[model samples]
Each structure stands twice: as structure tokens, then as C-alpha cells.
Target: MKIAFVANTCWNIYNFRKGLVHHFLSKGDEVIVLAPKDEYTDRIKSWGVKWLDTPLEGTSVNPFREFKYLLRIYSIFKSERPALALTYTIKPNIYSSLVSKWTPTKVICNVSGLGTIFLTTGLIGKLALILYRQAFKFSSYVFFQNSDDRELFTSKIKVESYKIGLIPGSGINLEQFKPLAFTQNTKTKFLMISRLIIEKGVREYAEAAKAFKDDKNVAFTLVGKFDTNHSRSIDEKELKQWITNGWIQYQPHSDNISNIIESHDVIVLPSYREGTPRTLLEGAAHARPLLASDVPGCREVVKNGYNGFLFEPLNSSSLINKMKLFLSLSIDEKKHLANNSRELVEKNFDEKLVVDAYEEAIHRIIKVS
Candidate 1:
């Protein structure tokens, strides 16, 4: 069987969905990635998967560029005609599904996150909603990361409820992310891992970092790509100035995500919204307490005082308060939060569950093929 996984970036496929890709390959199915090549493209291809660099102007408003993206997707699908297609992010999901009806491929779309477009009702938002309705009409199944997203699509896109499935946000491998024995670090470090985008609350994080610059017990670190082309990206000069003033230690994006989490006492993501934050799941798997916004995806991860804390979505002051509270925790309380985080992951977010569900779905398509 030939299976194609599509996303906006190869890094997304490499980071979030690699476990599922490996599962299919282990069963003797050929896996191919359809996305724009990035630093991780060659690395993922080295795993014996094929790569096709399908480019789209990520934040462009030009219709000509979008039409070109559609044609490129259709050309690829018409040629390869994979047994199945799994698409994440907006453009891939929409364009791939639009072409699936003309090809033999069965389409499954994962609505990872709604993104900033849905947060407003501007012209672009209206256009996106129209495109989604047309594209999703061709999808064999639509998997949403959360129930909120499913409901929104049902009401807005008018897609049938039966066509929608709920999967945990790109599940975490329990065995691989097994908790290391709890060790106390001399300085309590808080790490925020995400794209340097305003929607991820990068601005709020920076503000919080600035407020706590004088604290001796707390240290803040940030790790993720600085996407200059993104509409919501933090200004390069501003980000550099933050690091220069000793507000936050910045690390270049690296493949060693597990090690980075291990070194930090707590993991934070102040995202404005999420499908289900993979960061929180990974952090919990490492027995690190989580601090995140109380939005749909994030609140599900942190159990208030049980495992970690949650603050108002865009409130830097609220974020600062939570940081102070974390810093004031007793050693025993901190230990309990770490244990609770790991326990929550084991009970809920295990990667095996997600893999099993997808494999079953794919097998159904294979039988008829």
C-alpha cells in the first residue's frame, strides 16, 4: 500500500506524525511525505520515506498563488494516486481533499488547530470558510483534535457528524517518553517551546520573562524556530533584544526535544489556541509540570493545582502571577506535580491508542483497495 502524509512543512510531519508513519512502514506499507522541504526534509527522507516539495505562499492573499498550489497538489495526486492521504494544517487538507474525488486516494483530514483565521471575521476568514466547505465535501473522514473543533465544523461547514472522528492530538509515545527519575536542579528553569508567533503568546511570554528578570530562583528559556515569513511572527530585532538584555535564554530549534524538556523543571505554552498541544503531552511524559493558558487545548493538559497551573490566555500579568506561584512552591509540592503530570499522560495520551485507531481506519480503506 502506498500512503501519503501531507502537511505545510516536513518538520511537522517529522516531529508530530513520525510515529504513525513508522507504524505503517513497519507493516510493509510505503510512506511518502507531501510538503515543503525544510531542514528536516532530508532527515525524514532518510527514514526510507519519499519526499515531494509542494510549495505554497504560506501567508499570501493572492488568488493566483493559491490556484497554483491547487494545481500542484492535483498534479501530484493524479500521478501517484496513493492508496490513502492523511492531511494536516489548512492548505494541505483543503487542496488535497479537493483533488481526492478525482483520484483513487482516500482522504482523511486532521484539523490540528483552527488557527488565527477563525478568531476573526475578516474577508480572508470568510474565504477560508467557503473553501473548507467545498474541500471537506470530498473527504472520506475528518478527524478533529478536540470536540470544540468538531462542533464548529459541524455547524459551520455543514459536514455530516458521522464523517467526523476525534483523535488525541498527535499522540505521545509512552515508552520513548518515559519519565526520568526526578532530580532537583539548582535553579528552577521554565522552558517554552513553540514557533515564535504572536498567536502562540510569544509576546506574553516575553513580557513575563521581563517581569521575572530580577528573580534569582527562576530562569526562563525559549526554544523554537523564528519564522520570519509568518504573519504573527515576533519581530527579529525585538526577540534579539530580549536575549541581549538577559531576559530569556534562547536556543536554536534542535531535534533533541526530549533532552531539552529533561533539563527544564517545568514546560510552558501560552498559546492563544491549540488543537491539543503536543508540547504539553511531551512535557507530561517527561514528568515535568505544565504551565499554560486556560484555553480549549491547554486546559485539558493542566489539572489546575493537581499537576500544573493555567493563566488567562493573553494576560502577561496573569502569566507572571502563575510563574511567581510556581517559584514559591515547596519541594514536596513540586515533586507531586511532576508525578501527577506523568500519571496523567500514562492514563490518557499514550501514543499506542492513537496509532491503533489510525491503523484500523487505514486497514478499512486497504480492504476495498
Candidate 2:
């Protein structure tokens, strides 16, 4: 079978779903990637899969740009003629679903997250819902990372009930993200891994860090890219200010990010929303306790007072309070919570389970075809 994956960017495929692609290839299926080429394009090719560059105007609300992206993807779909087409993220799921409806190939769309458009009330939000309702009409299966997103799509946009299925966000690899020893030594390091954007709670983390900077034993670190999509992105000026003020240590994004996870004592993400946060799963798989917002995606992974704690969305004081709780945990207590985190991930968010779910969905579609 030939499988084609349509996502927003090559980076998304490389960072989040490489394991899924490899799983497909190992099963002797021809895998093709249809998305915008990036620095990771060559790396995908190295996996012996075909990479088709489809230009996408990400975060653009212009109808003309959307039409162009649809045309480009439609051309690619017609040419590739794969047995199945899997789409992820917002634009690809909407456009690819519409394009594949006329083709003989089966289409599966993953609604990774609702994103800011759906969360914010405006003309754009209404337009996005309309597109989603229309696009999902013909999809074989629309996989949601969380039940809340599924509920929102059905309740808000009123998509057909039979079209949706639930899966934990791109599952974590148990072996790759093995449990790390949490040696609560002299100083405790807290890590927040996410794109530096307002929606991601980057500002909240920074604020909490500032509030806790006086405590010599507590240190904060941030790992992520500067998101240019949102207005609240930590611009160079602000990031430099925080760094100079010694609020938190900042690290740029990278593909090989395992070492960074291993180096931290705890993980925190104050995201306003998420699909299934890959970083949170990674931290949990590494058996590191977490601090995240009490939002849909984050809440699904973290059971408050168990493996991790959840703060009110966008509340810096709540985030600070949670960080202090983490700070107060003794070495043995931290270790116990860390172990619980690994157990939760192994049972619920294993990468193998995610791959199996996708494969099963594909097989079911093929049987019907």
C-alpha cells in the first residue's frame, strides 16, 4: 500500500510523526510526505520516503492563499495516487479532505488541535468552523487528540458524529523517552518546553520565573522557538530582557532534544490549548513530574496532585504556586511522582499504541475500499 501524509510543514512530520512514518515503511508500505519543504526535507528523504513539497501559506486568512494551497495539494494528490492520504494540522485536514473526496484514495484527517482561530471569537473563527464542517463531511475518519476537541467540533461545528475518533496526541516512544533518575540535589531545575508564544503560556512561565528568581535553589529554563504567528511571541527584545534579568535560561529549538529533557528536574507548560502536547508526553515518559495549565489537552495527560499539577489557564500566580509546590517536594517524593508519570505514559501514550491505532484505522478504511 502507498501512504501519503499531508501536514502543514516538514518540521511537524520530522519532530512529531517520524516514528509513525518509520512504522509504515517497516511494514513495506510506500510512504510519501506532502507538505512544505524545510531544513528537515533532506532528513525525510534519508528515511527512504518520497518528499513532495507543497507550498502552504501557514496562518494566512486570505482566501486566495487558501485556494492556492488547495490547488497545489490537489495536484500532488492526483499525481501521487496513493492508496491512502493522511492529513494533519488545520489547513491540510480541511483542504486535503475536500480534494481526496473526489479521488478513489481513502482520506484520514487528524485534528491535532483546534488552534487559536477556533478559540478566538471573530469572523475568522466562524469561517474556520464552516470550512471544518464542510471538509469533515467526506473524511473516512477524523482522529482527535482529545475528547474535548471532538466535543467542540461536534457541539460547535456540528460535524457528523460517526466521523470522529480519539487518539492520544502523537504518542510518545517509551523506549526513547525512558524514565530518568530524578536526583533532587542542591538545586532544582524546572523546564518549560514549547514554542515561545502567548497561547503556549510562555509569558506565564517567564512571570513565574521572575517571582521565584530570589530562591537560589530554584532555576527555570525554557526550550522552544519564537512563534511568529501570534502577537504575544517573545520577541528578541523581551527574550533578551528576561535572559538579562536572570528570570530563566533560554534554549533554541532543535531536533535532538532528548538531552534537554534529561537535564531538567521538572517540566511545565502553561499552554492555553493543545492537541496532545508532545513535550509534556516526552517529559512524562522520561518520568519527570510536570506543571501545566488546566486546559483540555494538558489536563488529559496530567492528573492534578498525582503525576503532575495543573494551574489555571494563563494565570501566572497559579503557575508560580505550582512551581513552589514542586520546589517543596523532597527528593524521594519527587522520585515517586516521577515514577508515576512514566507509568501513566507507558499505559496511555506509548508511541507503539498510537502507530497501531493509525494502522488499524488505515486497515479498516482499506477493507471498506
Candidate 3:
């Protein structure tokens, strides 16, 4: 059987779906990837899978460009004709599924998150919803990262309930992100890792960090790529201002995320929403306590005062309060939170669970076909 994984970027498929791809390859299934070429394209090709460059500009809404993208995917399906097509991100899920309606290929769409499209009430949002409903009508299955997303789609879209499923984000590799021995740092280190975007609460994080700027006992670190291309991306000038104000230290995105997580005492995500953030999962797997917004995907992982604490989404004051509360904990109390973090990931969010779900879905679809 041939399986093709499609997404906006080669990097996304390489990092998030590598386990599932490896699972199929180990089972002697031919696996191919369709995504825009990036630094990770060659790396994915090295894994003994075919890599097809499919140009997809995620933020572009130009009708002509979108039509071309659709035609390109249609051509790929017509030629490759894989038994199963797994798609992630907005464009792939909507466009590839549309193409699958006329092709022999069967598509499984992964709704990682609604993103900015669903956050607005504008024409774009309504159009996106309509597109989703039409594309999903042809999909073999639609996998959501959180229950809230599933409920939203089922309520607003006309897709059948049986065609929907829930998956734990992309799942985390426990062994690779195992808990390290905790050591008390001179200052309580709080780390936030995400694209520097407005919807991600980058501004809120900076404000919270600014609140404790005069104190030497608390330190904040921000790590992520400066995504100037994103509509909601934080301005480089503002980021520089925050750094100049001595509120937080900034680091460019790094491949050594595990080591970076280990160096911090707590992981924080102030995003307005999520589809099960991989950062929180990685932090939990490393036995680092979490501080995240009380949104659907986040609340699923963070049991308030259990493994971590939750704050009001987009509320800097609430984040500050939680940070202060965490800082007030004794060494033993802090360690307890850390231990619970690791325990939670062990009980759930293992990478194998995601691989198993995809494998089962593929087998079921194949059996039906």
C-alpha cells in the first residue's frame, strides 16, 4: 500500500508526523510526502521515502493562486494515486480533500487547530468554514486535536459524526524528552516557546515579564522564530523594545528544544487557543510544570494545580498571578508539580498512541475500500 502525507511545509511533516511515517515504512508500506521544499525536505528524502515539492503559500488568499494550488494537488493525485492521503494544515486539508473526491485516493484530514481563520467573524472565516464543510464531505475521516474543535466543526459543519475522531496533538516522544534531574536555580526560570505572533500571546508574555523586571529572583526566556510572514506576527521593533527593557531574554529557534526545556523550571504558553500545543507536551514530558491559557487544548493537558496551572486566555494579569503563585512554592512543592508533569505525559500523549491511531485508521479505510 502507498501512503502520502501532505502539509504546508516539509518541516511540519518531518517534525510532527515523522513517527507515523516511520511506522508505515517499518511495516513495509511505501510512504511519500507532498509539501513545499525546505531544509527538511532532503532529511525526509533520506528516510527512504519519495518527496514531492508541492508549492503552498499558507497565508495567500488570492483566488488565482489558490486555484493553481488546487490544480497542482489534483495533478499529484492523478499521477501518484496513493491508497491513502493524510493531510495537515488548512490548505492541504481543504484542497487535497477536494481533489480526492475525484481521485482514487482517500484522504484523512487532521484539524490541528482552527487558527486565525476561525478566530474572526469576517468573510474569510465564513468562506473557510464553507470550504471545510465541502472538503470534509469527501474525506475518509477528519481527526481533531481537541474535543472543542471537534464539537465546533460538528456543530457548524455538515460532516457526519462517525467520520470524526480525536487525536492527542501530534503526540510526544517520551524517551527522547525524558525528565531530567531537577536542580534548584538561583532564579525561577520561566520559558515560553512559540511563533512570535499576536494570537500566541507574545505581547502578554512580555507584559508579564515586565511586571517582574525589577526583581532578580525571577527570569523569563522567549524562544521561537520571528515569523514576519504571519499576519499576526509580532513586530521586530516591539520584540527589540522588550529585550531592551530587560523584561525577557530572546533566543532564536533551536533544534535542541529538549535541552532548552531542561534548563527552564517552568514552561508557559499564553496563546489564545491551541490544537494541543507540542511545546506544552514536550515540557510535560521533561517533567517541567506548565503555565498556559485555560483554552481547550491547553486545559486538556494542564490539570489546574495538578501538573501545572492555567490562566485566563490573553489575560496578562492572570498569567502574572500564576507566575507569582508558582514562585511562592517551596522546593518540594515545585518538585511535586514537576513529577506530576512527567506522570501525566506517561499516562497520555505518548507518540505511539498517535502512530497506532493512524495505523488503525489506514487499515480500516483499506478494508472498506
lDDT of 2 by residue, 213-250 (tens): 79898888988887667555677788888999999998
Query: Can you write out model 3's per-residue Cα lDDT over 1-369, one digit (the tens) per residue?
Result: 888999999889877988888888998989889999988999999999999889988778789989999998899889988988999988899998899889999999999987656776765677788898788889998899999988876888877777778899999988888897677899889999998988889999999999999999899999999988877789999999999999999998888898898889999999888999999999999999999999978998899999889999979999999999999999898899999999998888999989888877777777733
User: What value of lDDT does candidate 1 attain over all alpha carbons?
Assistant: 0.86
Lowest-sum lDDT 10-residue window in model 1: 360-369
Model 3 residue-pair collision total: 0
Candidate 2 vs candidate 3: the TM-score winner is 3
Q: How far is candidate 1 from the true structure (C-alpha RMSD, Å)?
A: 1.6
Query: Once superposed on the true structure, which residue ranges of model 1 sit more than 4 Å away at CA?
Result: 121-123, 363-369
The candidate that wins on TM-score is 3
TM-score of 2: 0.96
Model 3, residue pairs in steric clash = none
> What order do you get sorting by lDDT, best first?
3, 1, 2
lDDT per residue (tens digit) for residues 257-349 in model 1: 999898899999999888889989999999999999998788878899989999999999999899889888888888899999999988878
Model 2 weakest 10-residue run by lDDT = 156-165
Flag regions of model 3 displaced more than 4 Å: none
Local distance difference test, each candidate: 0.86, 0.85, 0.89
Instruction: Kindly report which residue pairs in candidate 2 clash with one another.
Output: none
